[model samples]
Target: SDGTSLEGNVVLPDGKEVDAGEVQEPISDEVYYIAPDKCTECMGFHEEPQCAAVCPVDCCVPDDDHVETEEALLAKQRFMHPE
Candidate 1:
C-alpha cells in the first residue's frame, strides 16, 4: 500500500473502540463524506465544530462553495439536534 489513506484508528462517542478499518470499505470510498450534511463550519469558529475539534488528523475543512445561510445552519443544527 504505497499510496493508501490513513486507517486503523477511531474513538466512538460512547468511549468505545472499534477496529473499523479491518471491516471497512475500499480506499476509493474511504475518505468520503458530505459537506452540508456532515459539517456546519462552526458558524463563528469560536465554538469549534465538535467534528473538527476532535478529528485527530484535522482532515476536516470548510466548504466555502457549500456555504449555508444562517437560517440554513440553524435548520441543520435543529434537524440534527431535534427538540
Candidate 2:
C-alpha cells in the first residue's frame, strides 16, 4: 500500500457497511462541494479541471451519477458564486 489503499471502505447511504464504490460522498461548498450550484467545474477561470489539477493524489473523479452537461455546469457556477 502506497500509504493509501486502493480498496477501502466509505460510509454507505444507509449508514452501514458497503463497498466504497457503492457510496457517494457529497461535495461541500465550504470545502469544495462543487456547490453543484456553483461549480462551473472550473468555468470562466480555468482551462481544465481545476480541482483535479490541484488535487495531490488525483483522487477527484467525475461523478458519473451526478453527471451534468457543460451548460448545466456553467449554470451551476453562476448560481453558486453569483458575485
Q: Once superposed on the true structure, which residue ranges of model 1 sit more than 4 Å away at CA?
A: 1-28, 41-46
lDDT of 1: 0.52
Candidate 2 residues 22-64, lDDT tens each? 4445665455554342246677568887888889887777766
Backbone clashes (count) for model 1: 0
lDDT scores of the candidates, listed in order = 0.52, 0.54
Largest TM-score belongs to which candidate? 2
Listed per model in order, the count of residue pairs whose N, CA or C atoms clash below 3 Å is 0, 3
1-83, model 1: which lDDT tens digit per residue? Answer: 11123245544333555553554344366674544443445543347677777789988776767877777766545433445
What value does the lDDT take at residue 75 in candidate 2? 58
| Model 1: colliding residue pairs | none
Assess every candidate by TM-score.
Answer: 0.44, 0.49
Pairs of residues at least 3 apart in sequence or in different chains that clash in candidate 2: 27-33, 28-33, 38-77
